[model samples]
Target: MPIAFTVTYAVFAFILGSVIGSFLNVVILRTPEKMSIVTEPSHCFSCGHRLAWYDMFPIFSYIFLRGRCRYCGEKFSPRYMVVELITAVIYCLSYLVFAVFQPADWWKIAFSAVMFPVLIVLSMIDIDRFEIPYWCSAVMAVLGIAAIFVFPSEIVWYERLIAMGVILVLFAVLVLIGGMGGGDMQLMIGASLLLGYRVFAGLLIGILFGAIYGSIKKLRDSKAEKQLTEQIRDIAEQWYKNQLDRGVGYVADERSDVIVGSISDGAPDIEWEFLDEKVWVGLPDKSELSRMLRQNITDEREGGFKIFISGADVKKVKYSRRMVFGPFLAVGIAVSWFVGAQIVDWYTNLF
Candidate 1:
């Protein structure tokens, strides 16, 4: 291809990506809140002033506006500009890698075009909500299915199936062990089909990044976690006393475990089934206690609390909340799309 044509295509790709990124901003903001992405005009969240066309030109608009609403002058998040820039850059890279460099693998351009946007949306949403949308994973799975027919020579269909199955089982164990979530598992299951054996490389990269972030996050959150533990201990002590006074339940001699379930917007997500009926005189309404606990805990991330007891003494209280893996996994997936084959080959050569 001529240099002129290549540059033109790359420029077009960047423009297209920025436009898509602009739309994705709506998706990331609305999807978690169950708001409609379509039929909703772009408006300032602070003032509800509808944005004009000139105000919504992706990266340029944000730069020109100084990252503030025209109507309210309220500061907008830098994320809007950042997402658009990243998407635009990724789009150009995909075209260069798949279309310009390896023209024979042109189909990969389509794969990356759709896959990267979904990854971006899911990553941002996971960061904000601590959950990955099922639809995002489903879209990847559909892409994986389509890739089987479009690029059969790249990887055998059965290999894709095998990789997906293996990932499903492996991630299931990880989820049970509390090392990962079902959303991460589902995302990888679809990714395995698309990348075949290369999905393992993606997973490895994702885990490596997640582990590093987890370590740093753990250190940073240690103070908050300690404060939360103390709060939980106090709550548990009072609740235990109340239960004992009401003749409802008492911590069994051998089994002294306190479990708090997932807390959400409305109801406390605790699983009452886990509590042993044998040790309880009667189950008490947990709503009041749950409400109180919710007031004390203020983090938006999804998590649970565990309390250990030893003969009427609160031994320890642990709060477990892991950083979102979707973003890290997404980074891995994007990298694998670019260089997974080389990575796989290098690892095999070591043997």
Candidate 2:
């Protein structure tokens, strides 16, 4: 009987999780794009066709559709299936930790279920854009504070204060050193509120995960750089040989414009024309070059005048699913274990 009940619960939780995860997919994509997640019906971005009920069935729908839009025939990213599957796993695990373990009050179980989705959304947003919007973090912080009061085995206010204070200070130092972003600082504060002293464990884990991630990325980047350099050298050598065969005198002059051109049937094919003249070289051409010139001029115009327009190197950023999902899973399991133990003790005392 117990075995049957556990199986039923797991299946139910999986379905529920997949549904919630489907909603989360909408939030993750729409929120960063500043679009209405609720108001906009699930539709094909390519064809603008509204998704039918069958087409909206979370993970199964994607599989049945063969990962293509029904109306537009546009291929959907496999990430849709990946997100739904991940959410389903999180949901099932939360249920296993809460329901099977018998936590102190059903409230904590409900709260864990709700918090997991929020964490998933925020983590994805941070990974995608590297920014946690003020409103989302603020709301999470407020809710975490409120959870402390609502739960049966309540954490003291001082403990909450201590956790928040310690994380805020640590995050401040990180931000000062340019090690973390302001959004990360806010996220840490919210996490501290939720996890209390356990936040230290989370912080240590996050740092270790971040370090491993950075190392792997650095190796990949080094390989890519080496390949690009070799490719560029080969192209340059071929260009020089072609110039010699054509009897063209190539002079590397600092004052003159450097026009990198190709010859197709002995006709000059200008690939790029780099002008080394003054930055402000009169008005721009009123064609395709006008758009390019306008963008450059705008950047130059704002360079010294804008307070935020500092010269900073930009790099491509990527996020690992394990890093984002792992902490939340750890915290949820920890909280569930603590609450479940208290519940077991209380039940034992009743006998």
Candidate 3:
């Protein structure tokens, strides 16, 4: 292709990507809340001012408006502009990789088209809600199934199946060990089918990134966690005391092993099945204490409170808050998508 045409196509790709990125912002914001993406007109979250055309042009608008609502001057998150720029760059790169350099590799282009948006949306949603939507995984699985037909010469169907099975088992173990979330596992299960053995590379990259971030998060939140634990102890003791005063709930003494359970949506989800049923009284109240605990904890998906009992009283409470792993995992998957084959080939050659 001529240099002029190539540059033009790249520019077009970037522009198109920015437009899609604009829509993706809507999806990222509304999907978690179950709001209608199309039906809802773009408006300022701070002031409810309807966004004008000039105020909504992807990357430029945010820059021009100084990252603030025009009417109310309320600041917007820089994330909006970042997403647009990232998407534009990815689209331009995909054009260069599949169209300009690879030339007529429409299948790669199509895969990139579907995969990039899903990764972006799911990554953002996971950051916001600490959960990955099943639909996103389903789309990837469908794409993987289609790829089996399209790239039989590249990756066989059975290879994808084996990859899926292995990822399922590995992630299942991770979930059991409390190292990963079901959402992360589910996202990778679909990815395993799509990427085959290359998914392992993605998992390695994801875990590496997650570990680094988790270490930083741990250091940052250590002091806050200690304080939070103290508060949780106070809350648990008071709540338990109230329950006992009301002639409800059993006495969990030192002999009674550590009571382990998690809080979900500001509710105490105690592991009641293991506890004696005859001594059980009533469901733990989802009181102000529970709400406060939930509010303090960052990652609700893995947030749990450990109750240590002594002398028939709540002694201490330990709370663990984990960082979200979706964004890191998404980054790994994307890098794998682009250079996983090359990475794998290089490694094999080294051996």
Candidate 4:
């Protein structure tokens, strides 16, 4: 390719990627909030001032205004710039990778460019809101299905079906075991359509990564709890010894009054009455095994020293299928690209 043509293509890709990224921002913000993404013009979240055309130039606008809304002066998230930049990079990289390594297929390059933004949106929304809207995955699935015709030699129909089946079964098992949600299944189906059989491998990788992350967090919390318990014990011991030295009838068996206050406020008695009332109102019993597991896994522990093991009827928050769908899709794309490129190269060499 001529240098001029390459530069022009890069610039075009950047602009296109920025525009798509802007739309993705809207999708990410509105979808989870259950709002119309198209109906509402871009506006400041704090003051709700509608953004003007000049104020909405993707990465540039965010940088020009120092990452704040002009009307309300509310700080815009740096995520906006990051998303736009990432999209642009993906677009350029897609073109470069296709042009350099594979056949100069514009369609393949375009498809790769489009998938990145969609995946980016899904990943961000999943991270922030812990949910993924069905529409996003549906759109990706539709595109993936259509791409089968557009690039028939790249991936096969039966391969896609097998990938979808495998992921669907895996997701169903996770749901049964309370490890994943329905949205994850839908997301997986969509991703499998795009990536075909390779999606299964990507999903395995993502699940492994997620599990490792969750385990690390649990270990950190456990260590913090142990440290806090030690601190509380030391404080209690000191207070008890001081009281004993003063001879104020402070009972050592009950520990110090201050220590009692610390532990009492920190570890309030479980409000079983409130939970029982909720159960009477058609809510699941607080004593359910699932409820207990959710409390153990999800509840935030406060106060370093006092262990608050209160069992209340806490709301259960499940993993969003829609959110996981994005990362899975990204993984599929990467796997597909590598697999497809290698296969294509092998065939070309043999011919």
Query: Which has the greatest TM-score?
Result: 1
The whole-model lDDT of each prediction reads: 0.83, 0.59, 0.80, 0.61
Q: Per-residue lDDT for 171-255 in model 2, tens only?
A: 8897776446687777667767776666665666567666676677657656544443343334334443444355353323222
> Model 1, which residues run further than 4 Å from truth?
265-269, 278-281, 298-301
lDDT of 1 by residue, 263-318 (tens): 44423356666665565445655675677776766653455667665545667777
TM-score of predicted structure 2: 0.65
Worst 10 residues of 2 by lDDT: 301-310
TM-score of candidate 1 to 2 decimals? 0.94
- Return the TM-score for each candidate structure: 0.94, 0.65, 0.88, 0.64
User: Over the full model, what C-alpha lDDT does candidate 4 score relative to the true structure?
Assistant: 0.61
What's the lDDT of the predicted structure labeled candidate 1? 0.83
Report lDDT (Cα) of residue 291, candidate 2: 32
The Cα RMSD of model 3 versus the native structure comes to 3.3
Error of 1 at 26 (Å): 0.9
Q: List the residue pairs that clash in candidate 4.
A: 132-322, 132-323, 183-321, 184-321
> lDDT tens digits, residues 1-351, model 4?
778987887788778888888877887777777899777777778998888988989899999999989998889889988888888777777876776455688877867766676678777876675555677678778877876788677668887778788878878888776545666677777777777766755676567666676566556666655554554444334433443455533323322111111112123122333332321223322233223333333332322122221122111211111113345445545655546445445556997
Q: What would the per-residue lDDT of candidate 3 be over residues 203-258, giving only the tens digit for each residue?
A: 89999999998998889878877876787787678767776787665454434435
* Candidate that beats the other on lDDT, 1 or 3, i.e. the better one: 1
